[model samples]
Target: MVVLTKRELEQIALPAVQLAAPPLALVPEVDLSAVEASDAARSAAARAVAKACEDHGFFKVTGHGVPAPLLARLDAAAAAFFALPQRDKDKAAAGAGGGSPPFGYASKRIGDNGDLGWVEYLLLGVTAAGAAAAPVALSEGAESSCFRDVLDEHIAAVRRMTCTVLELMAQGLGLDDEGVFSRLVLDRDSDSLLRVNHYPARPEAAGEPAEVRRRLTGFGEHTDPQIISVLRSNDAAGLEMSLRDGTWVSVPSDTRSFFVNVGDALQVLTNGRFRSVRHRVVVSSARPRVSVIFFGGPPPRQRLAPLPGLVDREGGRRRYRDFTWREYKTSAYRTKLADNRLCYFETTATS
Candidate 1:
């Protein structure tokens, strides 16, 4: 487990610009079924997904079989969790997760360098047992049992979808059909963490016009560093990703679909075959927004590096030096999260 001191988190540098674009383009609403069959279609899907990943590192997935009822229940539960009074929410604050760096509630505006994003969060991690251990149920009282049941179902569905998408990525990268998923996601302690976020609209003053302060929000530009991230956002739009040419594009929640993005860890395991896009959320003045993300990855101590096959062969010689995933993550977690320089190192370790 890792713990981030207030001083350490306070030292991180925010993006130089307040609103920056991500590094790619977004291929909105892709059908999961269309890409699951035939080598040719899979190849094409791979190419398209790869291109989108390379360009923006983020895309929208649709036609996934996750039941709509599940999504509704999850969303409602998320709302209930965030709706708790500040005091109740603080009961599960970050430090309570036995010193784990990424769990529990995190208030907005506490990040390094005064980067003020308008959101609060409660983070959860899943173990191989197929369910996240109940660190602290929303409420021990039965009134919130529905929240627990619905959230449990939603997590299961997200885990399944995560495996399906990762398998496709493996096939697209020309590895064995079950390649990446098995290697990157160890069944026992794979990271299937969840981040339940609340992006509050900018507060209005007593008599101040509400419209003037309506456009504030939840987060700033960044990318997930894990394998894949499945996210569900409220109607308010603030999530944005970067493009290859350096433009940040907005990713809005559509219908019942969840937003998916490739993370830095996957890029390394695939030897840079895929990319992790930069993204951030903005605060709003009306209607608070809540989002939950399921992050996929190996255990904390797993050594992460680009697959040798993707490294040495055709194009450029191996681009990064091999390093343990935990080592790299430790550095990232210890320092400013924006510094991506060390994530790609070159060394003569393994093939």
Candidate 2:
């Protein structure tokens, strides 16, 4: 919310001279079009996904079948909603109940420490039954009745693509049950969250040197707690990932493609064969950026552990202990966003 004026936006805009060049050779791109093609083609695509998951836990996806017009419409709607005043945006707030899930507009200050990110977001929950249980209402000032319709269509399309991707990943891992991954995520009670993020330009800090101010981050480093996350963003680059070597690589913003990242749950299911990506968003002085992310997880009551098949194949060693989605999520929410939530669930042998 908090409709920012042109002058206010400009005040936070980073100067072009301070912008860093995009990093190279970070994450590879996988073509989803090959997923349903000939066996050889599908296998090749699966191999690419496997490699990306094992090495970086992140990859870009093209030919995902999401219409360009639909993506544009979703972006336009989000921009319009975020441009409204704070009071107007709060009409659909997550509500005052202490037990409410984090499912609506979350402003800058979040976490126990009141850490501030230069971003604001609207979170909507979707179930396997169909679209969001409570569909997001378009702000009246948005002046477009079609906004909600387009958004719903977009969410539906992405969910289909998410399931397909999971199937491919399962095949890539040599799983006999092709639907194992898909079933875990598409269950009727699964909590699939769609987050629409708006990262405004960084404001100039008085009396601080330009170099020092440029070091501020929009969001601190962290890994997702779900099975996977699919993200689409505008051309303003800010996302970065931590490599195994401890180097941080910037991910170029490519609006036409979706970036997929493995999450903690997937890592456990794969018996640590796959990795969970640790990444962060850096604030830019250029222009404000917008991104839409879909995070998929298992049903709240579903017990999660390294697959028995994977464990038996790997000398019967379990990397993580069995835990329910409810337990994992509770632990995740109780700590700072940047903390490594997976550490809390590691098997005692590994610990």
Candidate that would win on lDDT: 2
lDDT of 2 by residue, 148-208 (tens): 5766687789888888888889889999988898887789888788888888766554455
The window of 10 residues in a row where model 2 has the poorest summed lDDT is 92-101
Alpha-carbon local distance difference test for all models: 0.65, 0.78
TM-score of 2: 0.88
Backbone clash pairs for candidate 2 read 14-285
Q: Which ten residues in a row have the lowest lDDT in candidate 1?
A: 1-10
Best-performing candidate as measured by TM-score: 2
